[model samples]
Target: MSVFVTVVLFLVLAVAVNADIEVDCGHTEVKVRWSDPRSQMEPSLLKLGTCSPNSFYDGKAVFNVNLEDCSFRRMVTGGQVIFLNDLTHIYDPAFSQPVVCAFERHSDWSPPLYTPKFNTYGYSNLVFQMGLMNADFTGPALSSAYPLGSLIPIMAAVYQSSHQPLLLHMEECFAAMTPQPQPDSPVYPIITNKGCLVDSKSTNSRFQTRERTSEMHLLLQAFKFPLGEDVYIHCKLMAWDPEGLDSSKKACHFVKGHGWELLDDPARSDLCRCCDSHCMARRKRGLASGQGVMQKTVLGPLTIIDGSTP
Candidate 1:
């Protein structure tokens, strides 16, 4: 009878220790830690929607997520906003009471509204504008809904009064859930390296040639993001001398049958090979550090009804 009682006590302690879940919330981030009493528990068992825990160490599941990321369910009531997320264990049958996190949106912070990136003297007297365009790349888009897998023509332009003769380059771009891209908001990369159409690496996205060099037509596709249904395109736009077309500055797209191709001059396609790995500047320049004619353009809240539910 004493041996039986000892076994029962150990099992009770094991269950109690394994079920402990702690949630820590900050202004912009949340950290979740779950203790594991069983040595056989795997990190894949715990999930935050489609996101896995950031790390698992020392018999503990450690999850770090931004408040605005992972599509935390948001609702408004009484002029206040609330965000909530529930955690689930994929394989744990006894985990009926899943851990949950809910918090009121901070009164001090909200998503910033974006305006047309017009002429800015600070950015080296450059006039910038970005928007969704028509299929022919002639003008702005007219429809509200776009079919899934269809092309999305996102155009960006720079108007310069003086003929400084600067070549435009898009270094990187990501699709977000909101108009104002924040530091912690979740994002999906569409372009990378100096100008690699990384999304085209998987989907049917590429750059269309326009007559004018100032304007660029990025042909993207409509899809449902893991974070949210809404999509925003934010890009880092830079202007450099045409003579200064270095590896750090390029426009490239991956062809289905072929490899990476440079948009401006296909002869120098070698410059974009770094897109497969990483793009590093030969030297640190003031422009790359944020002082040059570089600006971030946010275009979206783009209406994409990609998926429908009955």
Candidate 2:
């Protein structure tokens, strides 16, 4: 009788422990953990599966959610669903086709973090495609709505890579509901780096004038971002001429990159070396001429902050 009682108590404790689930979001990954008392010895049993004929646990079941599906927008509290179709106005045709996942409870959606309203001098066309752990999404199982608890991690990874600011346009969004930074507050810091330029010109007889010119290379990096929170990096470029003549105007260009992309490829070794080199060379020559030709540029990194499991 004592042995029977002990077994009952053990079963009860196991069930209690298995009911809780914890999710962790990292710079480049998301992890979901849960306990299952029914098959404590076989963790795989808790994974998504279908029930078999005449079996209690063998029925057709889906675990992941499609990020694009209307159902997902309804499930998430105060979540706003932005489809590729809606982004075409601000993005190019190539970008118009990529998938995007956005959730905000704010009354008004802010311009893109890197790309802001044109008058605001920010990049306005950055977008993201939904996938699983940087892998291609093959079906509904891998969609953002899937129950894999992987979304947070994936978001964190993207933020870590791009460091581009994430604007929580929704006031009541999950991140905003918590005591963390408010949607309108600038809680994170913006890092700045030096800009370089390159130029080639030849002196002419009876006439000396500068005509054709190009910009030099510029690079910037940012770090230490909160998980699941929006982040942004802003980069701008300014230039001047050899005769100590600054351009009558400054040309501003912005590129939108994500933290997850940075975390996924932190080394940034995948950048186009050939194009970068040309840009850098231009900056170097412009500076060497001592003619006053210089360029100033900025890069913005943004993402949201969230917690991770130890």
Candidate 3:
């Protein structure tokens, strides 16, 4: 399962009051900084589970906690992986705020970003694979070479050898300069907001018809960024109920004048409307027991030749 925890933060660039705070979500940790410009907020007065404020700097009380520590509650829903916690204070008996952090599996080749909570029963046997595909989509692309502006067909599949009924969805995708994107790596958004193909808004990139519920396809247009070097594509793949198609869980693409349209079933394209804005995720009630809903895979080192160069 994949997960994103809601870390509520009250931020102001231009101005703010005494209770103002800022949050920063790292690859394997969550940081909360309470600004005390007036020296009104005391570090000892605040707490996150059993963790106390770790430091005081820049007139702020800082709490930096690991994702797995500080009494974090592990949760999973429909493939999202998440850890949750709450901040309690002696200052206000009724005041409480949630703290959350989440991370996805990058790939077998990449280093582990954070430890995931596995089911007490068993680990997910579900196998996922992604690769560059040939133009006809008949087989894997013989070469990972594409001229700028050319379409790069990417095929992602969940090998359901047991023939289990499963529907695969691309949750999010981004292009990076490195095959294994680090937390600090600069990235270009290709698909965002669950399955919205944001790159399609500017180019011909978009999702294609799926051959099976366990498979997803994307025709990504090559770009000139980083100019003649290789680009890597990373995507979060999800497996969900075949009938549980919701706005936050869909494959949508921009159609120029038609706005966003679903790839598999345009009849339910209304779900694609959320692609224009934020898609409200379902409330996380508990832990993802087994092979929850999501898996992130990598595809790349694909060469992009800028046609303008030669």
Candidate 4:
């Protein structure tokens, strides 16, 4: 009788274990639904205290869960955009156990207006390092899909990379501006006739002093409707490593030259000429004063063909 009772107890325990499921599907779905409060909150709860067909609302929140092999799919319904930052977590079986995951959504997604590609010449290579503020601009600019501001960080990076004294040769520069209406009437100015200078001189006796120079020309113009607004074009010639050089040491120097000039009569073989005689003159003087010759290095010019409206 004692042996019979022991076998019966083992059978009961096995049955109980089979009935217990680790995953609670209903509870998991409920948690996901609750985490997306934006979908459930009444329009009256909005800061405006009302919701309309055009009412826009955005919220950022996180949810943690454990799941396995999770993935997500998104679609637009009723002209509303919904972004599931981490769609995989919901489908992940691992999420069925208790774990933390993140979810974020925004009603407004501002796509880029214009993007430009960075052109390289000869054996030159382009290196880009974007600051936190302009990180969004790098990828789009390289693809030529986003506007001019998006390339600012890229420009900074390229300018910093040129081993020789650089110049902002504006003859090849291009600018694209989005023609959106603005309250401040801000204009995006284009750069024309820009170039950079790089000083390769070493101050210490252990290293040799060398001077290198390159020249380029490009056209820059601000994006403005009237095309005659008082637009300002700001250009900077910074050291490759400003911190590495002493403040008193000049890494590179820049000097502006004459603008576009008419080549006498149009009947002449040359219709027009843009000369940087002043730059050449300054370079000669520098060389005479112990600065080395200006070595020509090729950095591809960026050209802007048109403006955008988005």
Q: What is the lDDT of candidate 4?
A: 0.24
How does each model score on TM-score? 0.58, 0.21, 0.57, 0.21
lDDT, each prediction: 0.66, 0.23, 0.69, 0.24
- Best-first order by lDDT: 3, 1, 4, 2
Model 4 C-alpha lDDT per residue in residues 18-100, reported as the tens digit of each score: 12111112212201211233344432222100001123234322222322112111223443322222222222323221212
Q: What lDDT does candidate 4 reach at residue 48?
A: 9
Of 1 and 4, the candidate ranking higher by TM-score:
1
> Who wins the lDDT comparison?
3
Q: In model 1, what are the clashing residue pairs, if there are any?
A: none
**Model 3 per-residue lDDT tens digits across residues 40-116:** 55656677754678986666677888765555555444434555666767577675677655555322222223332
Answer with 1 or 2, whichever has the higher TM-score: 1
What lDDT would candidate 3 get against the real structure?
0.69
Identify the runs in model 4 with alpha carbons over 4 angstroms from their true place. 1-117, 123-189, 192-222, 225-281, 284-310
Worst-scoring 10-residue span by lDDT in model 1: 5-14
Worst lDDT run of 10 residues, candidate 2, spans: 198-207
Q: Model 1: per-residue lDDT, tens digit, 135-171? A: 8877677753467778888887777776466677788
